[model samples]
Every structure is written in C-alpha cells, then in structure tokens.
Target: MKPLTPRLHGFVDYTACGLMLAAPRLLRLSPQARRASYALAGSYLGVSLLTDYPPALRRMIPFPVHGRIELATFPALLLLASETQGRNRIYFLALAGMVAGAYALTDWKADPDA
Candidate 1:
C-alpha cells in the first residue's frame, strides 16, 4: 500500500490500519500509543464479527460504529488529543485501526476456518 496523504482519508486509514495490526511491535510507540493501538485492534476484531450477523443489522452496525467512534472523528480527535503526544502518529494509528478492521472482515469472510 502506498503512503497516502492526509486528504486521502479512507486509503490512508486502510494502509496505516494494516501496518498497525500486522506490525504492532515494530513501531516506536509510546504507552498511550500502545493503548490506541489496542483500541484500534479491537475495532478490527469487531468488524470481523459483524460479518456473521444478519446482513441488515450488520449493515447498520459494527463497521459504521467503528467509523463513528474511531475513524470518523479521528483526525480532529488527534488534534484535540495533543495531551497524548505524538498527535500525528496517533491519527495514523487510528486510521490503521480502521484498516485492520477492514482487513479482519475480509479475512473472516475468506477463511475456511471462519
């Protein structure tokens, strides 16, 4: 995946999210950053679960909830969360969470085990 710009929100979210889940230990993240990573990872997990739900309710929840709670306000939240330090990194981290969520959902559908 290319390193997309801040303006390419969806793409950026996917790429960063994939990196966060796929390479959690590799990044030079802080304690707060770690928590952020975990939250993002959990969000991805939720996305994976949503696939099993009825198509109607699944369409109404999970990914959309993750988007609203995490991805949607992420950029602005990152700005406000300057208290956490590494604001820019956190924003990308949140985006990464969204990516991971999408990825997990994909894998869940594709996997023979799922």
Candidate 2:
C-alpha cells in the first residue's frame, strides 16, 4: 500500500483522539475533522503495530519479538514528528522516522530479478 503523508497522518491521529474523547454521545465533527480522525486511527494503528507489543503473553513466547517493537517504532516516531512541529523533537523524530521508513522499505523491497 502507498504510504500516508506525515501531515495527514498527524491530522488523522489528532482528530481521532478528539473524537474518542467525545464518544458515546452524538457529536458533530467537521468534514476535515472526520478525515483527519480516520487517518489518525490508521496511522496510530500502523505505528502501534510497529512499536508496541501484541500482548504480554508474547513476552513468554519464543523468537526475538523485540525486533518487531523496533520496527514498529518507526511509524510511532513519524506520528510523534507530525505532532511535534515547530519543536526540536519534531526535527529529530521526523528525520528518524523518514530515514528508518525509507531504509525498511528499501531493504524489504528487493528487485524481482534478485
């Protein structure tokens, strides 16, 4: 799948969080807000899948799942960067996320001939 833009991801995540906080009650969210919210959920899920754990039970299972955590953190960093605009952390997080994502995608995608 094609990747999402950093700003879009940020808006999505941000709006979703806002919606959740206002949940169980019918509320009006602007179209822009809704789009932003959906993207937010998608980004959050993607990032969390990369950076966070599946479950505590995974800890007891075999295989070095820490690799998964490290891999997932790339998306997390990107999301953080999106939120951290104009802040010092944004520079670092954005750089780290973009670099890591680029590396992972490139490394994962070998030539069909290869």
Counting clashing residue pairs in each candidate, in order, gives: 3, 5
Which pairs clash in model 1? 16-96, 17-96, 44-101
Q: Give lDDT for model 2.
A: 0.39
TM-scores, one per candidate: 0.41, 0.28
Against the reference, the lDDT scores of all candidates come to 0.46, 0.39
lDDT of 1 by residue, 17-80 (tens): 5665655456666666656666666564555334223322243344334344544545644543
What 10-residue stretch in candidate 1 is worst by lDDT?
Answer: 105-114
Q: For residues 37-66, could you state the per-residue lDDT of candidate 2 as single tens digits? A: 455445444453342223222223221232
